[model samples]
Target: MSEGDRDHSTGSGRLVTGAAWAALLLGLWLWGTEVTDVRHGLSVPATGDMAAVGRPAAAELPPAAAPLKDARPRRIDIPSLRVQAPVMPRGLDDRGGIDPPPYARSGVVGWYAAGARPGAAGAALFVGHVDTEDRPAVFHGLGAMRTGETVRVFRDDGTVAEFTVDDVQVVGRDRFDARQAYGVRQSGRAELRLITCGGTFDRASGTYTANVIVSAYLTGTGP
Candidate 1:
C-alpha cells in the first residue's frame, strides 16, 4: 500500500492486527516463567551479577507494575524516509496520549506506553497500521526498512534516543511471539520494537495474517 493509502483498522475497535495477536501470545508465555541472565555485548551492565560488581542490594518487585522514571516520548521522526509524527503516550485509561483516530489523513505516529521505554531495561514498542479500509496507513513502508537504518524518538525532556536497526522479521498472526518481540533484553541498554501489518489481507478476518517486526537497539544518546 502507498503511504497515504495505509490501513489503520488494526488499532481501532474490534480489529486485531497480527502484531496484537503476537503480543497476546507473548504475555501468555510469560505468565509462569522467570527470565534470567539477559545479556548483550560489553556495553550493557549485567543484572544477574549486580553484587559481583559491588552494587548495592536491590529489592525485587512485581513485574506488571514495575515503576519507571524515564522521560515520556513526545515525538518520533525517521529522517531517511521523511517521516515525522507527534508522539502520544498510550496506556490504561488511555493514560499515555490519544492516538490519531484510525484512518486519519494527517501524519501522526502513535506510541504504545503499555510497553517499555527505549534505552531502558525493557522492550520499547511503537505500532501503526498498514492501511485503512479507504486510505494508506502511517506505517505502510515499515516492511521496507533495512538493517542499519536509524529511528529517532524525541522525548519530552528534550533528549533524543537513536536506535540502529538490528533485525526485521515477519510472524504469522496465530504464532507471533510477544516475549521475543517485546520482552527480550540485551544488556541494560534500551531496545525498540516497531510493528505494522503485513502478509496477505484476509477479507473474511478483516485483518492481515502476519506482522512485520523491526528490532533495534540504542546506538547513542543526544539532543
Candidate 2:
C-alpha cells in the first residue's frame, strides 16, 4: 500500500511536486483537446513505465444522466476501493498550481474550488496524496479502478450524484498534456477526475515519475 512512500517525509513537497504537478496545473488552465488517446491498456497499473488503464471493449456502461444543479461536494464514496472520505475545497497556489490537501490530511480529497462542482456539467477535479510517510492515502487504490464502477459524490444539495468510472490514465510528466488529462470527454455531462501521485518514486528527481488520473461521469442520482 505504501509503495511510493519510501524515503518520503511529511511536508517534503517531493511527492506532490514530484508527480509533475506544475505541468498538470498548466494543462488544467489550457483546456484544449490537442490529444485524447492517452489510454495504454485495460486495467493497467500506474507503476513502472505503464501510463493508464483503458476501458474494456465489452463493458456496458450506463447512459449519462442529466447534470444536477451546482452544489458543494461534502464527501466521496468509492465502494469498489472501500474508500469514503470528506471533500475539501482547495484553491490555486501563488505559482498557479493547485494547492492540494496537506500531508497531514492525506485521508481527504481536495477539490478545485474554482472549477465545476462534482455534480455540475464540467469536469470537477479532485486530487489526493497516493501515500504518506507511513501509510497509503485516500487515493492509493484509485489506479486499480475499472470502467463501470460507481463513484458517488455526496453534495450539499442533499442529493447523491452517482458517477460511472469510464477512463483511467497514468499521465507521465514528460508527456503531460492538460487537454488530454483535464479536458472534457463529453460535452454537457457532469464529469469527475481523481488525480494522485503515481508511477515510481524517482530518487533522483525527488518526486513521482507520473500521475494517475481516473475519469468518471454522472450516471444516476439518488436521495
Candidate 3:
C-alpha cells in the first residue's frame, strides 16, 4: 500500500473507534440516570396477579390454626452467608411494587409492611439491594443460601422467628412468575421470601435482568 493511503486508512479507523467510544459512554449515562421507572420494573405487576384464580386473593388464607401473634421484625441475620441487616418497614411505591430501602442505605432490607408479618401463617416479603453503585449491599451474597440453612429474624417482642431455607431460585426479568416467586406455596405455612436483583445488568434499562428469590418457612420460634 502507498504511504499516503495507509495514513488515510489509519486516520479513518481512529475516527470510527473514537466515535464508538463516545456513543457507548453516552448510552451508559442515559441508562443509569433515566432508569427512574425501575420502581415498577422491580418485578410484580399492577394486577398483583400471583394467583391461580386469575387475580390475587385479597391476601393469602390463614392456616387452619390461628396465626402466631404478630411481632414486628427488627433485624434479619442469615448466618450461613453472614448477612445481618436492619429491617425497615416499606410500602408500595408509586408503581405498586414493594419499595426498596434507600440506595444510600443499601446495607439494609425492607419488609413489606402491608403483607404478612414474620412468623405468621402467610408469606412475609423482604427486599434488598444487591449492590450499590460500586459496593456490595445487604443481600449481595444471598444466592449462596443453601437448603436447610438457618435464617433468624429478631423482633421487638423478644422472640426470634427462626426459618429454615427451603430453596433458592433465580427468575429472569423477562420470565418473572409472581405466583411462584411470592405466593404462598403451602397453605397456612409461615413463609418468607428474600428478594434482590440478579442476572446480568442491562445497560440500556439500568436494571438487573433477573431476581434472586430465596424461599423459606418458619420451622421454630425462639427468644
Candidate 4:
C-alpha cells in the first residue's frame, strides 16, 4: 500500500480506466477478515489481470427511493465493521479521476462531490486510505464488511441514510471494469460505493495490484 511513486498510478489495462481509482491508494499489508463475493483472500496476482467480482445487476437489486435534496455526507458509520469516520468532500483532479483523501488525513473518508449523494438518485462514491507506510488507517478493515450489513451515512442536513451491503468485490486492474465499479445501473436508484486499496501490496511498485470495492444501496433513512 505504499503508492509513493506518483499522484495516481495508471496502467494501460482496464483498472485505471475507471474512476474507481488511479493507483492513488496507500498502505502496507493488513491482516483480518475481508468482505467478498468471489474469493476469500484480498491478495491478487502481481499482474492484477484476474476476473472481477461484484454485486449483481441493477434489476436484481431492490429499487431506490426518490432522490434527496443535495446534502454533503458528514459522517459514515458501519456498526459491524466498527468504522466511524468524518466525511470530507472531494473532487476530481485535472485528469478527471476522483482525488483520494490526503495521506495525512488517513482516518477521514473522501466523498466525491461530483457524484451522487448518499441517498441521491445515482451512485455515490467514497474513497479512503487502506493503510500508510506505518500502519492501518480508516479503511483497513474495509474488506471485512459482509453482505446484508448496514452502512449508515449522516448528511449535513441532519438526515441519515442507511444502506445495505449488496456486494463486495476485489477487482484487479487488468480485469477492472469502470462501468461495473462506478456506473449507475438504474437512473433513479440510490447507490453507494466505498473504495480503497486492496490486494497484495507490491513493495517493488509501492502499489496494490487491485482495489477493494464495496457496493450498497439505500435501504432506509432516519432523522
Each model's TM-score, in the order given?
0.67, 0.84, 0.70, 0.73
Question: Lowest summed lDDT over 10 consecutive residues: which window, candidate 4?
Answer: 26-35
The digit string of per-residue lDDT tens for model 1 on 1-223 reads 2222225434343343332334433443332233334332222111111222332222331122222347778877777557777766644223222232244443456566655665555567776666665555666667666556788888877788877766656666666555654545544446677766666676555656676777676776678
RMSD to the hidden true structure, all candidates: 12.2, 4.8, 15.2, 9.6
lDDT, model 3? 0.62
Sliding window of 10 residues with minimal summed lDDT for model 1: 42-51
Candidate 3 per-residue C-alpha lDDT over 148-177 given as tens digits, one digit per residue, 9 for 90 to 100? 778888988998988887666666656665
lDDT of each: 0.55, 0.76, 0.62, 0.66
Give the deviation of candidate 2 from the true structure as CA RMSD: 4.8
Off by over 4 Å in 3: 1-67
Per-residue CA lDDT of model 4 for 74-144, tens digit only, reads 99998976989999998766555567776767789998775567887777888887776666778877777
Top lDDT hit? 2
Please tell me which predicted candidate would have the highest TM-score against the true structure: 2
Task: Rate residue 220 of model 4 by lDDT.
Answer: 84
The TM-score, computed over Cα atoms with residue i paired to residue i, of candidate 3 is: 0.70
Ranking of predictions according to lDDT:
2, 4, 3, 1
Model 1, residue 149: C-alpha shift (Å) = 0.5
> Residue-wise lDDT of candidate 2 within 51-85, one digit each (tens)?
23443532578999998999999999999889999
- Model 2, position 43: C-alpha lDDT score: 35
lDDT of 3 at 215: 75
lDDT of model 3 at residue 78? Answer: 96
Models sorted by TM-score, best on top: 2, 4, 3, 1
